[model samples]
Target chain A: MNEGTTVLITGATGFIGGRLVEMLAGRARVRALVSAYTRTSRIARYPVEMVRGDIRDEAAVAQAARGVDVIFHCAYGSRGTPEEKRAITVGGTKNVIAAARASGARLVHLSTQMVYGTPEKGVITEELPRQEGGGTYAESKVEAENLVEAAAAAGLPATILQPTAVYGPWAPVWTVGVLARMREGKVPLVNGGEGACNAVYIDDVIQAMLLAARREGALGERFLVSAREPVSWRDFYGSYEEMLGFPATVPVRVEEAVEPQRRGRRWALPQLLELAREEPSVRSRLGNTFEGQLARRLAGPLFRRRSTPSRTPELDKLRRLRSKPELPVYRLSPTDASFYASTARVEIGKAQRLLGYEPGYDLRAGMELTGEWARWARLVPAKAEEQQAQQKRKGVEAQ
Target chain B: MMVGAGRAAESLHLPAAAMTAQVTTSVIADRNLERAREVARNYGVEQAVAGAEEGKAFADAAILALPHHLHARVARELLEAGLHVLVEKPLALTAAECAELGTIASERRLVLEVGMVRRRFPALRFVKRALERELLGGIRRVTLEEGMPFAWEVTSDFTFRRETGGGVLADSGIHVLDLLAWWFGELEPVAYSDDDMGGVEAEVQFTLRLPSGAPVEVELSRTRELRNSIIIEGERGSLEAGLAFGGALRLDIGEAPLLIGQAQPHASEAGGDYQNVRELFIEQLENFRDSIRGTSSPLVDASEAMVAVGLLERLRAMREPLELPWVTANTTRAA
Candidate 1:
């Protein structure tokens, strides 16, 4: 399918799908199927047709899928309750695939490496069996991919692209979130930041997804599209501090990373105990108010106005050992810490040889490009290119 | 164009060259020749040298993104070779070292900028301009606080060394300290104590007297998160300069009680990147480039960073050291 073909992008207002619409606008007849929740869309600027519909709604997916030669299914829930996740992932995929089948359109399904269940093996290839337990996001994605594989086996022209930790200009968790946190002088590095962050640049993933549409060898195949080399979360993410223009500090060992089991007991047990100690409704309200006032009175000393030498004598200061008046450091949910620890590197030779995919952007280049967009958007403050141009002009004057 | 092709140079500072007009990396030198070559390749730099000596002719000026202890040594070499230089913070470990470097820059007529990134924040810049504009009265009480848990991935070992001016104080504290000096002129350290933990302090608390007799209380940490803000009480009223970088200079101004202060969050906006460090860093570079072009002196000079280092040196000297449990984990990445 080329310029004459009709293409429908399910999550056209999203980061990846929006980018795809931009790339494919002139190449084909592009129609964007954006959900009502698409707050802001760059695709709205393009000449493509807009179809407002939730992917989970069968009639909406079917109506939008009508007359399209290629359906690039990319929408999924990033946030919601558990039932909503399943509806967006498994239920939504089922509706999209059925529409694609009904329309005889080629389905280019966007899946995630999360299906592999945070591999224990260092280098995962596509041949490995799909592990079952990676929470709702992974499990739901796996269920969707399973439906895709089944549809392909039943003779629907379909392809699946499993993109790894996709990060770019607008990728919330990776680029924006990371840069945002770096500004605050904190990045929660799990397991001393030694875990693999199999980060793939968005451009690379886009290229692979595009190639999946046209490549003859991609029929009925699942491809893992990622950077050739996996970066250690430290070397990969630790560099964010230096890149974002802060002096690098020794990463503090997160208790959640090093001692996750005990952290649960330390955190949840007290809350559970407090909840278990039931009182009459009126007494509970009064006790809560009293407790809050008492705690405030106790913490009053910490906020006291001080303009003198520390009262504690030198060497006898053990009494105030852990007493500090500052902000609480970066705290991650135990689940998040575990996710950081379990991130795995994988081989992408299948994408290279089969789909003719080349992982063009390394971690540095990817981050640099993201920084460029961030600079354009005024997220990051430093500008090296401007400085370079000034230097060139100065050299011309000197010569 | 840059020395020390380590993590900082590779990430924030290196990319910053691309963002600024007159600044770009022509060559990068690192201890590891391959690493230098790799950085040069990644950033599209033309030449990758093995050491500082080999990169002398590549660019008009150089940014010293090296570690804290190595600033003066590397800066001196670059300065003597007739290269304009920008040194990263804790400009040098000592005032005398910074002075020596400053003398050379003066003799050579080369611009020597210091990498005090936070000063470039819109909020802090606004705060300084407000003080200079005399819209606010004489300083009364200053509270400089930043608390966030220690959660960065540290790769290099030298950052943990005491001689190198390592730990949270030098790494994160210097920015707040330099900002304090920038706003209030100078600070006389009345009291300083830190959770030394043997190698370096993870947390520090200080009582400083500003020139206007304002007691500037500072708290910095890599252990806990604190309200990352600056509160100033003047003769007329008080203003809180909150959200230092990549966000608004959230200010609240009122008479006696700040609780009754007017919340002027969107009072001033439109920084390069109000919420990102890169924009402030770019602003700093832009100022440095302008200084190089004879527009004006940089917003922060070598002296500003030197004052911060001097304070750090004094704090370290007066420190009541406490030992933290010595434990090391082999956290090398699995193959």
Candidate 2:
């Protein structure tokens, strides 16, 4: 099915996008859309038509979408302002969808599990309602996916593959960030780090993206892509040390210093911005940013350093609900406590049943491959050439 | 002085230098010799040096990987030494400095190129060609919006500090702005607003007017999420370019969007469709080389760099500050 198919892969220099280019190199005719800052290292190895233009540009996307059979829309930005994110995520998707529609090509979009907003309780599925509040990054993804859904409703051929915490080669944020923190003895456990984390290896996610491209059933459908086993945050780091054969490094509990105090004085805030401003106009004192801050702060605990109780009624109540703990790393600040506290396992049943997607690598094998690639990419240390050689001889960790 | 040994140098500059026909990395410089030496070894450069002077002594031109604030001072010193210079984008923290550097490069007769590498991409170049070809008729309006989650695993402190020319506008905004200038002359700002919250702006929106009264809108950020692309609305039709994967340029004339052209990874002079993004960097380098050799001007010269930086400063001046409970979500990687 892959033979003689023309494909377009956007964000080709990014971690997942880079891998997609490598995997699809010999399989099909590929066209790549990358950014100005994109380095050549990830993409130069493959033979793909590399285009440079912003996705917000309708003309540029239309130009790239010409003559392609299917497009692997694997590119989306996670960090920017609300309007900027809306323009790119929601607006950019519209452009790609239009391009795909114009050319009569199918789209395999790479999305994230954050659309469901890291369910704090149980396994999240494709059927769950998207969060009304998933922070800026997650919120924007929800908007982007909505655009894709609207396009599909209009008869645009497209499939959405939402992956969980993906870690692997050149994963500048997840894999490398974690190892760097761990090796430097900056491992901190927020709320004891016991929350579930669903991680899918990079290659596995790449496999799912490719599968969704060819599978007819995948079109007009949304699939949750994750691994079979979901591990806790502690086990996640523990496995890293074990795979490297490094002695166990204890995780520091940093609950008190980071988590917000929840028992202080209370007030009602149904609409945060409304309370912030006396006027009803958009340009009033309470803007989107102001309202957002007011609402989020009122709804969540107030993060602060632990200190002696003032002995007042409200202060005592707050003190009773809060306690202080050590801060291991400045990098692992209060937000991380919330992140680690809120993580929930995601379900990949849809990907499994529809796309026949199954993870080929367990945590052990995935980390091994990731380690090998990380070492080659110079993102992690290779203690010895012998240790590097030992990876090939090693097998999957005992389940 | 190439003050840092981070991604831009490792993944981009050196590799592209290797691909340049006559260009070869002569010096690898960084505060960290370990990284510098390793980088030198990877690219087969002859010398690996540390600190400011030791590094600048070996190369005829230095790619300033230093923090943004340091670009002006270091480039001036190198220029006095009769050396050419290529500074990373956002030429300097402000517009005046960029203009001054452009003046110095001109007086020195040395090639000074800002690595706004997008102009070197054949696909983007194709968009410029199509626009010039009037495929999209008369330009009416243009919108350039690009945003990504700021998840770059950078260990450099300079990237975070606003005084040192860090932040979303300086880092990500300049690239998109440079491209905007290239396609639609210097975009004049009509109004500007941003959500900076006393830190670097995570998001910015610009109401701009293109050359000949084509209204343009520009959105840039480091806080929220989106796809990076530009949409140009012209008289006859429209154009869309995806800035995510190298770049993909498309055109539509009344009917469904037609994929009229794609990026030719190399400029033919970039030595035969070199397989990697090195081709774009290599093409940029070749432009620098040709400019120095008195063969051609830099593809994105210092003056062009000044235009983007200058406009950026004006926008920053006009941006209304925002107030939000800032989350100390790790702004950078903790290596």
Candidate 2 Cα misplacement greater than 4 A, ranges = A183-185, A242-327, A330-339, A384-399, B1-335
Candidate 2 per-residue lDDT, tens place, A1-399, comes to: 354888888877778887776667656777787665324333543455667778899899999989999888877765587788777777788789999999999998888887876556766889899885766677777887888888898898899989888997667677877766555543544555677768888778887887888787888999888778787877777766654455323333443323223312332343332433432221111212223345445753431221222335574344223311121232244445556776566778788888988777677777777666555334455657656665543222100
Residues B1-335 of candidate 1: C-alpha lDDT, one tens digit per residue:
77888778877888788889967778999888898888888999999898777898887888887778888898899889998888888778888898888899999999999888776666667788778866657766777778664444433434544666666778878887788777778788888877553345556788788776668888875544566788776666666766445333443455433342222343354244344577666777778888889997976676667788788777777775432211111111110
What lDDT score belongs to each candidate, Candidate 1 first?
A: 0.71, 0.68
> How well is each residue in B1-335 modelled by candidate 2, as lDDT tens digits?
34467778888787777767988778888878999888888878777888657767777877877788888888888887878887778678777888888898888788888888766655666667777788888777677778765666554545544566666677877887787777777678788876543334556777778667777777775633454678877777788877753466677878765764445542453233645666767777788888888888877777778888888888877876542211111111100
Fnat for candidate 1 (0 to 1)? 0.00
DockQ of 2: 0.02
Q: What's the residue-level lDDT of A285 in candidate 1?
A: 20
- For residue B67, what is the lDDT in candidate 1? 71
- Output the lDDT of residue B191, model 1: 80
Residue-wise lDDT of candidate 1 within A330-393, one digit each (tens)? 4455556655676567889998898988877788877777766665344665567776886685
**Docking class of predicted structure 2:** incorrect
Report how far residue A254 has shifted in candidate 1, in Å.
6.9
